[model samples]
Target: MNSPQLAIVLGTRPEIVKLAPIIRECRDRDVPHIVVHTGQHYSPQLTEVFFDELELPPPDHALGVGSATHGEQTGSMIAGIEEVLLEADPETVLVQGDTNTTLAATIAASKLDAELGHVEAGLRSDDRGMPEEVNRIICDHTADRLFAPTPAAAENLRAEGVPSDRISVTGNTVVDALQRHRGLAADRTAVLDDLGVEPGEYGLLTLHRAENVDDPDRFADLLTGVGRVAREYEMDVVYPAHPRARKKLEDLRVPNAVEVVEPLDYLEFLRLESDASVILTDSGGVQEEACVLGVPCVTLRENTERPETIAAGANRLGGVTPTGIFETAREMVGTDAEWENPFGDGDAAARILDAAAATDADGADDSAAATEAVQ
Candidate 1:
């Protein structure tokens, strides 16, 4: 019924999870905001369930721009998001993480009158081979507001010559969302029981990145590596297969110790993450979640955007080889899980809103609005 003052654009499960706190903040503040889902991740299990689990309002707009080539997906989402921006005519448009949806929303909002804010800004893996890295760089350069999750991220923005005025170290919303929902996840989900796994006994594995799964040789080596870790540690691993990765599983000799399961909902996955002995993943969000959850993590990549996890001693880069994965898993499994969280306290959502509200619709400073916004 109200003309939305903010437009939150997202498209993947990680986006939904990371942005949930902001949506809740908006509701609590009575800030009229509309959610636009670009359908980059369209599966109901991955997408719709998050809205329900997070108690978020259904998306105001869903652009069914399903699977396509990188260019096609980004192009389609830009057109769809532009249409939503035109109609909603919000004062600010916010997008989270590095995805086609983020890039599209950034490009769309850049051309419009709305100020564009990028959540999880200035994360660089320094791997130009990854499409996500490209998207992150483009979105950061184009955004009016850069919400860096950590001081390191803020420094990266500064090094890139991003104006200090346009940047804010608002922490990572994943911490906010995780702190709020992990208790609910523990209480509401019996995923551990359903999977016949006990707390701190089973390993959690997730591999969806194109670099890891798209190559047959690399995928096979990763599975073999997990198998080595499982056998060495005497633990069974639950691999919640992403749709893209699942397709490549056919005819591949999956390790007997690694049980491939369908993708779990947010609550289920969170429960698993909270209780697992070690988490092996390529997802940046999972890296943050693992760090926040105090779970030892072994990244299945050579480099990561979330290097804070590594510097915190909560995570180790395992690369994509059997020897590397096994060694990292062995090293991480012995960790105490007491590493300090490098992300931030669970108030990022509030700070981000504060920053956004501090600026007027025309992008001018308004100290009174900032104070009122936090009040």
Candidate 2:
């Protein structure tokens, strides 16, 4: 088989969802590309199932580098991704978001004869204590092309002294995936009924960040705060527990008003986000989705990379304390969901691919130069 022109590297569920549109673009344009799953999220539910749901081709390579310490996990992913890069020898490698996989793939691709493009680049939470903050910083600095999702993100790249030529404000791909699939989710899934909640009457909750869920006290506090708000409003707060957070839930005291359920599939989750009155999450992707879906959002983090949501009045930062959560929920729950979608017009995939194809063309020219020099 001929070497692919592009290698799309992903590991977690969000990566699959965000990258699905780009992969589809490659297929539609008949661009030669291979997908490599680093298996940072090894669960079939989290990784493999998204391919089927998103109607994406199976990953050409699955590394199966499951959970471990940060060092151990990233180390395994770097080694595994290096092997894939060596074999495929793609002209460009694309990675998304700030996962261990993204950092690992960036490191591996930087060492090889490949141009690296980082989607959703130049986002800075400015909280280096967060593992994701560190991962994203490294990926942005090392990547050859930075696909900033907003002008603000592009400015961030500029502030970092990344040449403006290297950064493109391609918007966030989550908008593309949401716009494409939301109608399908509404029509195909009965997730609201299955969860025993009424549309526009329930609060959807998702907490998975290690800073939020790893500590039993913080985890319990977040749940308690969210649950109290749900009770105050006489609304049910549905928490779809991530695999990482489930273990913490087992040891904690869950509130009565918060119903903790197993993680839902992409369609189910999308449907939930659309129909819910408000969304409470620590996931950056969820913040973007809730904003686009016109559902008010209260981010559990003290700070967010997607400050666009806050500036647009579509979201609020609700810290981990119960009072803070309650106050923010009280402030946002009754507001009109009329905030304009700050992300884009649902065509980020095309812009990113356009930039990527240009990068691939430049790589060919550079390769040709090397060959001539050797001759």
Candidate 3:
């Protein structure tokens, strides 16, 4: 049996959804790649549910390294990912986004002679306080090949002193995933019907980021504000609660006007998101998807790594303040979604594969060297 040349490492639902196009591209080209599940999400519903919906193959390796402190989680991932890399010895390991799994897998692969490719590289909110910002900075530095989502992102790498030769402007893969699965979502998903809402008649809400949900007062403010907007606008607000956020519920029925639901799989969620009149979310991916789908998005974060979304007028920043959230949602409900998408033309996966292959063709892995130079 020959060892695969590429290993795609992923954990959590967002990573799976974002990486689906790359995984499918590998299959389409008959490329030798292994899928390794890091189990950073811990729940089957949040991990495997996506693979099932996307028709992805089961992972070649599964590391059930569940939740832990940042250090513990990342450390656990490094040990487990090291075991897999040692056995597989792929020429390159591809990780997406800025989850602990991505950082851990990239670092562990670095310890070996394996090269690293980051799918969503050079994204920065510039806030070191955000764990994801830290993860992306490290991953971008360590990656031998950096697939940036936009020109702005590539410029960020250049600003950080990453070599121009290694960075490829691959559009956000979420657009690819949306294009591929949205029809399936619309055709198959009954979530809108199940929720008793008409297309463009309601707002979709997804708030799970630690910054928003961690503080009791802030979280309460967000919900209260959203509820006020929902009531005033006479629109239903459907929230698919993240498991972590669900656990911190001070009042299940708080703002009883809003409907909190179990998280939907990717397809169903996409269906809901696409036709939504307005979108309120803290997830960066959601912001990109809303932009691509021409839905007005009110990001509930002070800053976003995906600034192109806001610059294009498809999105607006609505901080954690109740007033900010309510006013942004109210004003943004009238926002036009016809702006040109700055992410890409939905060919990011192909460009990523081409860049990655070209990178490895040069023979020597430059990951460690690049990291050293950047640092």
Candidate 4:
């Protein structure tokens, strides 16, 4: 019998990070898999560095669809992915998380009548303001297999009318990547020495959402709040700055106290998260990473899809207001150890693969049934 072929699709940094473990699993199992990059975040600094650090293989196909209007980007990816699906003819197409890549690929594969599997399915922020919410809803609805990261996510799927049988509570794959790279983290204290700081002596910060950085006032509020906390706590703050965040910081004349360095690779970021006294961020994956590493998180957004972290006391929503930010940081810095990790252990990638294999088995049975019906 021939081994099944799988096409794993990813375009952005978070997608690459979350999908790497599963790609490794496919290689170890001798499964024929091809990786496709949509070029949603094509940057030598961001995408290339992560691929190098994670040792991800060069993508077999690159759509080269760089930044554009959301509609334009999604349309381009869908058309490109449809062509790849026709050419590759893989038995299944795998997508991770709620990005334009995920929604576009899901639409392309479903239109091609291929089985779709969604990792990190069923996340909801209940805020229609987020483009990601639309992507999440569309992908979950179309997926033949939904690999939810938590039971709460599974419940969200159930509430949204997804078939219960299609949803499986696999843990989050970010935890798998974190566990895999944490061994290297122990050897990475030089990042601290380079910054002239010690472990637990500072807060780690990251903010790069259009809503936050595009608004000059909101951006300044976040910067000022972080600087105030650093001063109040007598702590240093490191921001492995996103490109947009860095540009905004410069344009707004952000204060001197907040150190804005280039974004760190996965291992370095994980080490920073592990050692930081607290983490402040507007990124979803970082929120989950903080939870997995048992670091206190202050979300710099008005809402979040990962409310489980907040519920578990591992995180709080601080939005972009200076008062909100300072209060949340003070509370977190004072009570960092009080929170428990709401995300799961490191078995998420394995469980997700197991679910996909099971889905394949069931698909085979269904095909057999159709042939019998014809007979």
Best by lDDT: 1
In model 2, where do residues sit more than 4 Å from their true spots?
359-375
Model 4 TM-score is 0.92
Prediction 2 global C-alpha lDDT: 0.88
Better model by TM-score: candidate 3 vs candidate 4:
3
Model 3 TM-score, all chains together: 0.94
lDDT of 1: 0.89
Total residue pair clashes for candidate 3: 0
- Per-candidate TM-scores read 0.95, 0.95, 0.94, 0.92
lDDT of 2 by residue, 328-350 (tens): 99999978988877787778888
Candidate 4 per-residue lDDT over residues 35-117, each given as its tens digit: 99999987767687788888878988999999899999999999999998888888889999999999899999998757899
| RMSD score of candidate 1 (Å) | 3.3
Give the Cα error of residue 187 in candidate 4, in Å: 1.4
Local distance difference test scores for all models: 0.89, 0.88, 0.86, 0.83
The local distance difference test score of model 4 is 0.83
Looking at candidate 1, the ten consecutive residues that score lowest on lDDT are: 366-375
Number of colliding residue pairs in each model = 0, 0, 0, 0
* 229: Cα error in model 3, Å: 1.2
